[model samples]
Target: MDLDSAFAALGDPVRRSLVARLAHGDATVGELAAPFDLTSQAISHHVGVLRRCGLVEQRREGTRRPCRLRTDQLALLSTWIDDQRRTWADRLDALEQHLTDEGADR
Candidate 1:
């Protein structure tokens, strides 16, 4: 999955809300749109963006298509965030130790 596309697709509040709803469980487009003021077409467009980014998937169930959050893709994003956090934490720790050592020498 393209991380940039995934992040970009979620940059919109509407799309983020849809994702949040799906986190509870899979939902039909109509169910997803019920909480929003946007039209069905608008909701579909948002879902399409998520689908293209592999963040959401639509599967057929007897002519009804429900959307599901792609947990694997979400995990990938979480891993990326965790990796960044660790990198920054390590750098900050090193900087703090350096300042302390300098203070001791003075």
Candidate 2:
């Protein structure tokens, strides 16, 4: 999944909250909906976005549908952040070397 789609899915506070809840343990849709004032359908919509983003997975347990966190997708986020950090560090190091070289010349 693209980062844009994943970020869009995570843009909603409700979706983020639902993901946080799922991180604790697998929970049924009804159980997941309990903390919010929203309807089950609303919660389902949020969950759908999260599932599409690969952050969560759902399975039917008899009549109940339970949702669980899939942490592997988080590695994608981690990787992106790490890449940006490395790029910034490289630039900073270059700036430091340039300053040191100028000082030596002075």
Candidate 3:
């Protein structure tokens, strides 16, 4: 999914908390909903959004559906971060070269 969808899915505080919980381990819907003040239905809706964004996965085990974090999507975030770092490194290298050349001229 695109970054916009990922960001939108994570925009909710409830969704963010849910993701954090899933990070520890996979949990059933009931387990995920237990700590929240909201109803199970509300929690389910949040999970649905996360699923749509490719951030979480849900699987049925007998009768219960367990939710788990899909970390592969996080590669998109990593890729973006790496791109930013590369850009900064290039700029810093250019500045260093400029300074060194200026010093040599003095």
Candidate 4:
């Protein structure tokens, strides 16, 4: 999955909500469209953005195409976030140690 594209696609609140909803279960365009005030076309556009980012996928089932979450992309994003968290935590710990050492010296 392209992290940049996924992040950009998720930057929109509507897209984020869509992602959150899909986390529960697969949904069709009509179901996804029902919650929002926007038209079905707008929902389709959002879904397209998600599809382009590899965050979600649509599958053909009879007459309907249900949208499912691509957990792999979400996993990648989670991993990236965890890495950032660890790096910052280590930096903060080092800064705290340095401050404590200085306080002891004074």
Highest lDDT among the candidates is held by which one? 4
Q: How many clashes (backbone N, Cα, C below 3 Å) per candidate?
A: 0, 0, 0, 0
Expressed as tens digits, the lDDT of each residue in 1-106 for candidate 4 is: 8899999999999999999999999999889999899999999999999999999999999999999999988999999999999999999999999999999999
Model 1 C-alpha lDDT per residue in residues 1-106, reported as the tens digit of each score:
9999999998999999999999999999999999899888899999999999999999999989999999899999999999999999999999999999999999
TM-score between candidate 4 and the true structure? 0.97
lDDT for 93 (candidate 2): 100
* Clash pairs detected, candidate 4: none
Query: lDDT (0-100) at residue 19 of candidate 3?
Result: 88
Candidate RMSDs in order: 0.8, 1.7, 2.4, 0.7
RMSD of 4: 0.7
**lDDT ranking, best first:** 4, 1, 3, 2
Q: Give per-residue CA lDDT, model 3, range 16-66, as digits (tens).
A: 899899989999878999998888899989999999889999998899899
Give the TM-score ranking, best first: 4, 1, 2, 3
Candidate 2 regions off by >4 Å? Answer: 103-106
Task: State every prediction's TM-score relative to the real structure.
Answer: 0.96, 0.85, 0.78, 0.97
Residues 1-106 of candidate 2 have per-residue lDDT tens digits of: 6788888888889988987898799998889999999899998888888888888899988998999988788778779989999999999999999999999999
The lDDT values for all models are: 0.95, 0.88, 0.90, 0.97
TM-score between candidate 1 and the true structure: 0.96
Question: After TM-score superposition, what is the CA distance of residue 81 in candidate 2 from its true location, in Å?
Answer: 1.5
> What is the alpha-carbon RMSD of candidate 2 to the true structure?
1.7
